[model samples]
Target: MTAKAERMASLPSSLPPFGVGRLKAAALFDISPSLFDRLVESRQLPQPRLLGGRLVWDVSELGDAWRSLPHRLEDIDGFTTTGNPWDE
Candidate 1:
C-alpha cells in the first residue's frame, strides 16, 4: 500500500465513516491547518459538511480529492504573493 493509504488506515475505525474534524483531517493530510484552509479556499479540497454542529470531512472524499490535486497546484503556491483570500 502507499504511504497515504497506510496513514489513512491508521485512523481509528471506531469513528464514524463520514470522517474526522478539521484538525484531524489536516493532520491526516500531513498539512498544516493554514495550508488546509488555503486548499479549501482554492477549491482544491472537498467541501466539508456540518455534522452535529461540527464541521467534518468524509475520509473517502478527502482521499479522492487529495489524489486528484493538479500537478501545477504546488507551483502556483510560490507565485501567490498574498496569503489573504479576502484580498483576491
Candidate 2:
C-alpha cells in the first residue's frame, strides 16, 4: 500500500452508528464518567440498554436527553439562573 493509504488506515474511525459504552458516552458529552453516572442517576440522561450483559447507551437517546436539558445562565454578579428565564 502507498504511504498515504497506510496513514489513512492508521487513523481511528469515527464513533459507532448507534450505541456506545460508558467511557465513550462520557467522552461524547465532554464529561467524566462519574459525572455521566450522576446525570444518569438524576435522570438528566437516559439509562443504557443491556446488550448481551454489556451496558450500551443509545446515541439517539443520549442526544434527545441532552437537548431536553434546561439551559443555564450566569449573570455578571456570579448569580446563576435555572429553568425558563422567560417565565420570570
Candidate 3:
C-alpha cells in the first residue's frame, strides 16, 4: 500500500466507546448543559451512571438515543428550533 493508505489504516477506526461527562454529552447533542439536565429530569434522556464520583452517560447509549429522535422536530413534544444543532 501507499504511505498515505498505510497511515490511514494504522489510525483507530473510531472514537473509544465509553462514557462521557455532562458537558461532553451536551456538546454531542449540541444543546446547553442546562437543557441536558432538563432532559434527564424529564426522562427524555436516560439517566447517567455515577462512576467514580462523576456522572457519565454511555456514548453508545447517547448515540442510540440520538438516532431514535423524531426525524422531524415537529413530531417531538416540545422540540424547538432554538438551540438546535440543525439550525447552525
Point to the candidate with the largest lDDT.
Answer: 3
Report the C-alpha lDDT of model 2 over 58-81, residue by residue, as the tens digit.
Answer: 999988977766565644244556
Residues 1-88 of candidate 1 have per-residue lDDT tens digits of 9997898798897855667788988997899999998988888898888888888888999989878765643545456544648776
RMSD of 2: 8.4
TM-score of 1: 0.59
**Residue 70, candidate 2: how far off, in angstroms?**
2.1
Q: Which stretch of 10 consecutive residues in model 1 shows the poorest summed lDDT?
A: 73-82
Q: Give me the runs in candidate 1 sitting further than 4 Å from their true place.
A: 1-16, 70-88
Best by TM-score: 3
Clashes of each: 0, 0, 0
Candidate 2, residue 82: lDDT: 53
The residue ranges of model 3 lying beyond 4 angstroms of the native Cα positions read 1-13, 73-88
Candidate 3 TM-score, true structure as reference: 0.65
TM-score of every prediction relative to native: 0.59, 0.64, 0.65
Predicted candidate 3, C-alpha RMSD:
9.9
